[model samples]
Target: MNRSTNFVLAQILFVILLLTACSTEKTASDSEPKKKEPKKETVEKAPTEPEEMVKQGAGEHYEKVKDLEGDDLDKEIKELTKDFPKDMKSEDAYNRIIAAFAADHQLAFQELEDFDITFEEVEAYEKYSEEDGEEKKEGPLNVVILLDASGSMAGKVSGTDKMTAAKEALKKFAGGLPKDANVLLRVYGHKGSNDDKDKKLSCESTEVMYPLGAYDAGAFQQSLSKFKPTGWTPLAASIEAAEKDLQGKEGNNVVYIVSDGIETCDGNPIEAAKKLHKSNIQAKVNIIGFDVDNEGQQQLKAVAEAGGGEFQSVSSQKELFDEVESNWSKAMHDARINWSLSMDSSSVNWSSSGKGHSMRKVYSKMLDSISDEFELLRSVKMELYNQKKMTNEELDKLDKLIFSRYEKLREYSTNKHDAKQAALDKETDRVLKLIDENAENARVE
Candidate 1:
């Protein structure tokens, strides 16, 4: 019974071992990694073109602008820019056009204020009197007359040669001058004939016939008689020479230039005047255009302004005398006032005011309009540049127009300011004169 049991157990053990070997072989087969197949090379098709860039309505507006001219162009530009987009490229083109239009339309107008009639403070008068006294008492009364003897002066006006009328006017002016004032007569274009052959010699003819000092009336008259109307105008050269003549002369220098036309010797009289004004002499220039035409008047006006002086146009001897007398009377009054104010401390103080507040407002509005237009143009120009519609050359033209408009505004402002100041000064002078006359009467009493 023991042997049979042991045999059965051995058989069962062998069956268990065969089952374990089969399970091990199956696990090994499941755990091993499988080999992957190689991937096929990808063939990328060529990229399709991007969608066409969409353009704004710049081309359409540009075409519209090109077809317009004058008022129509201006009106259209104004209408287009009225509601223009801030960031739109086509807006730039509109701005450029509008800027040019505004520049062309810029008009200069002056607003003059009424003179102030009340004094601010006694101290102000005292200060002004002190400065006036310093100028009045220290310098010698020096007067230099620049007489033009250009060929044009020989032409007849009102049945008399302009040169003869000019000389007669000068003689009267010289005679009326205060005895204390030192006189100098400088004549230009007095040498050489008006012929083209004599051009070189005429251009070089600028001489101080009478030096800056006391002169005999007869001698001065003779000097005037010596020269006849001949040669080209050397106006600029004559003024430059006058600067040297006045050098080292003290007190109250006045320069009077009598000319028939603009500079014919290619010299810049305006520049010469500017140099003389800025010099240490501190002279005041007064220009008399002796029957000068419109073009000549314009140029002479610029010279007078630049020289800090006044310009007067005269066609006859009577007109010349009137202007000269008026100027002299004013000068004499100013001198007397300065002297009196300096001597007397008991005089009452006076002040000045303006009368053009309403006009000034109008002027301000106009200036604001210009400024607004300029800013709009500037913005538009930049926009157009970004849009590539404006070339550099075209932008430069716009820039010049903008600059010109700005300059015009500035000049207008300056002129208005000067006019207002002059009016106030004249009123002040009137008041001072009254006070002076009253003081004299009191002293006489």
Candidate 2:
């Protein structure tokens, strides 16, 4: 009844108390009667069409039909899509339908670059590429200005003498050429009077007053001052002289002739121009017929054609000055471009027009592709229905779906084109403005 009895009773009481607490915890308590319920887990519903699938588009459609056209296209398509899913369930199945018939929903910008078999090479070959010459290896540039110091050049035009006008233009041109370009000032027929007796001396007189070297303002001015118009024109002989000046020189070579008459020294100017513009010389001979008559214009124009150059006839001093300025600026542009490409591509090797045209071609192809896709889808759908592979309801649903995707693709392609076109136009304008600024800066007079 002492220690043992007391220990056993205490243990029994403790066990009873623990059991009572556990029982109370199982149900609502007096202090906090409300019992908390367990939270139910949520299950999210997936989207009908996945975004990644939409982005992927029915892009494979182009791959299948890209190599086919006309009846052959229809035949190949029918054969390929013979097993097209009749019961469209998964996103993949819908995408397959697009692949079989509809155009791709994703129109990439890379399609605009280079002449690939995927794109029609019409514009690539016909319009833009010809403007781009072959990549040429260059060493230096030679620009020769042929001044016709003939008696006819002493004549007046627009209140200014032809000779004086020619001198000012030549001075500005020679002084403004690119630093790397070598300029030769050639004066023809400056030795004799416009007399029949002095024809031999005048005809034979063609001198390179400012020898081939970098533009020298003072030296060029001195060269200009040393000559005066006093004899008959020696146009052909002058071309030959310029050819001699560029004999061993390399790179882009050019000759500009300021004349008022055709070759009167009995030399063939056209043949001379042909010789100068040969592949070996690679020289372009431009002729400016100042106050020339009809016969002189015809002859000079022919010479320019043979020389792979341009010809213009100016009856006024302003026209003459402008022609010279333009020719000089153009020549300098070519020299500066050493961009190693055609002058159209700009001096930095970016072809603004070319890129624009290519992009436009891409845009056009996109629209045509969309149209072609719609037609193919229509044909494929009708064939499926006729073969009992699909029902009317399925055809209608798929047609609507294909049309919707086509609309989105067209919108996407258009937006992309607009954005790229804006950038191309901006770049084009910038390059042209840069060229113009360069030209203005190069003008010394």
Candidate 3:
């Protein structure tokens, strides 16, 4: 119990207490439940054979059959598909083939569009003038009035003759026109009498009384007085003749046809109007049914639609005059804006010299080839299916061939497009700059 004995005893007791506390903590930890580690999720990557790769593989196979035709083509197809799995269902196999062909076709079209194939041709504007050689006002409004001087026009409408009403309306319309507008007066079916025997003469009676020129009120009135409604209606022939009358003239040309009846001379007015619409003259024809019946109005409406113009039904003189003036004003305004834009110096002129022209030609030819091939393949597939001569395996083989051809063409076009895009973009920028300058000038004017 001395000082040395007491120190040794205290050390032993402290060591025991530390050991007991460690053992108790370990027991408590072992009694509790252990937390389970979260299992790592394994995501399966999507099937690695991309459409592009499939197309590439198909393309290699396509080279073998591209040159084959007739029996040779059939023989090649049979040989290529001979190893296909026999257990595959026919419908399933057909669907797969169709899907592959569709993908390839889409890709081919996309690649083709990548090439800047648009040719920037410069527009040649012909300087129009009066017969006396004085240049017509340099605006874009050209109006042609087609008056129906047939027998029906002489018929009474709203306490006056249809012809009189039309004349008054036209005169009012002329007065409202802008000074810069060029106007023409064409009359049809005013030759022979409206008898069945004079049908031939009436049909061929189309004439341009007032040729395209500056609006001359006195001259147009004089021309109007000369025509009387004695002959049969010859609507179609007049339209056809009008196309020639405005042949070389440019700008927004509008034709206003005043009629009371349908064609009686076996001429197709709708067809004629369609031709005029699609012609290089860029004319729109508006039809005014002057006291016409339902049947006549319907036919006239069709003609107007074909000519890319509107149809107006007028029961009185006021409606006729109002419609004509409104349409003319609106059309002239639109034409002025359009003409200004077209004449802008920044617009692309496809006639320009350089690699652009050559590239356009090459791209055009490539497009034509691809189109022809596509059509040929489609026709062949359709023919075989219709004849029931093509088995599912054979169709699958053909699809592969199509896919390969498309893939090859796409690759070729893509390469060409990549090579030319930079140069094309530079040229485009130059054109755009010019357009911007022109637009500013137009706005200022």
Candidate 4:
């Protein structure tokens, strides 16, 4: 052990001791509790698009005729007589002819909801002359004329401006209407408020330029001239409004909708129509699509179905005029639509198809029963409301009864029985007859 070696060893020992002390301090610090980190939260996202719905439809039918004399005949005739106008055109005559045919054949006509048409305009004009002043076989009608007024229609109609053209056609049609008939004029997408430029886009929205009534053709046309095409099309709102206008009015209410485009606003025209049908609004909707796209055609067709009427697609002004003329003709001649289902070349025979005759009859009966129940409930409610002396308690009771009945009705409808709604079916036929009779009697003078 020399003195130099011992000094080196001593230096090495001091270095080791210092390192051990630092390690001890680090271990002690690590033993203390530390703050925990938060877990990242996740949020769910909603679907960015709506599911697509199928656009399929099944055809419908009507028994156009009935000669069941006495009360039965009266009941059947009454069912067929509602919602008809006093004056109709040749085009409106088809419904009547079909009813007569149905009666003769003892069979019903199968029809698509959108295929209602008038056969021909009756030209005699003097058939409705008062003979001995006997209550001239009464024919009364209420018609709604919907005219298109989008910017596209700004030009002349049949050599006149679009608005003018409509007025002219309407005037001509009215010339053939009975003096006692009612007429309502509706113009859509016609004008825009000066204050807003955006509103101009939807200028073709609907407006009731005239309520249902007998009036001068010249005056009517002049009145219609005030409207100009400068906005967007609000077809749905227009239809809904028209339905509201005809809400509780008497006689047959016909909605003759004329348009160039589909609905462009926040409205469901088809749904509105269905509302009209389900509620038995006493209004039948007939649609004329004037130069539209496929989508527009579909929407219009749906609207017609909801209205329990038909849709007519027009490609040109001439076609539009022709359709109007034909409708007038049908109204006068009283043509009936004896709808029959010829076996579609691509499908099986109608009789042998999935639904048999007995099943159909059963379904029809069920529907009739349901309709009766609803009518009873509705009458009860209306009566209660009419009683001005009804107390709050009574009102509450009525409301409960209505709700309960409706709930039951919904349940039954969901059960899938192909029931015939008697009131609805009867009302549909009545409307057609009244319109035809009116057409036969309508006079320009």
Q: Which candidate is the best by lDDT?
A: 2
Q: Give the per-residue lDDT digits (tens) of candidate 3, residues 130-209.
A: 13334334444688889999988888867888899888888877666767778888899999998889988988998888
Better of 2 and 4 by TM-score: 2
User: Could you tell which candidate, 1 or 2, scores higher by lDDT?
Assistant: 2
Best by TM-score: 1
Candidate 4 off by > 4 Å: 1-139, 155-161, 193-197, 200-205, 328-445
Summed backbone clashes in each candidate are 11, 0, 7, 76
Worst 10 residues of 2 by lDDT: 116-125
lDDT (Cα, tens digit) per residue for candidate 4, span 114-199: 12221122222233334432332323566777777767666554565555555666777767765656778888777663235766
Query: Against the true structure, candidate 4 has what lDDT?
Result: 0.52
Better of 3 and 4 by TM-score: 3
On TM-score, who's better, 2 or 3? 2
lDDT of 2 by residue, 1-445 (tens): 8999999999999999999998898654656766779786332222234233235445445577765778887777678767665654333334555544444535443464332222112222222345554443456677888989989888898898989988987787777777777888899989888799999999999998999898878888888888889997788888987887887875478888889988888999999999889857788888889999989899999999899887778888787777676544654554442442332334333344434554675688767866676777667666666556666666677677666656765676678678777766665565555445443322222
Better of 1 and 2 by TM-score: 1
Model 3: clashing residue pairs?
58-404, 59-404, 120-349, 120-350, 121-350, 346-434, 346-435
What stretches of model 3 exceed 4 Å from their correct place? 1-140, 337-445
Which scores better on lDDT, 3 or 4?
3
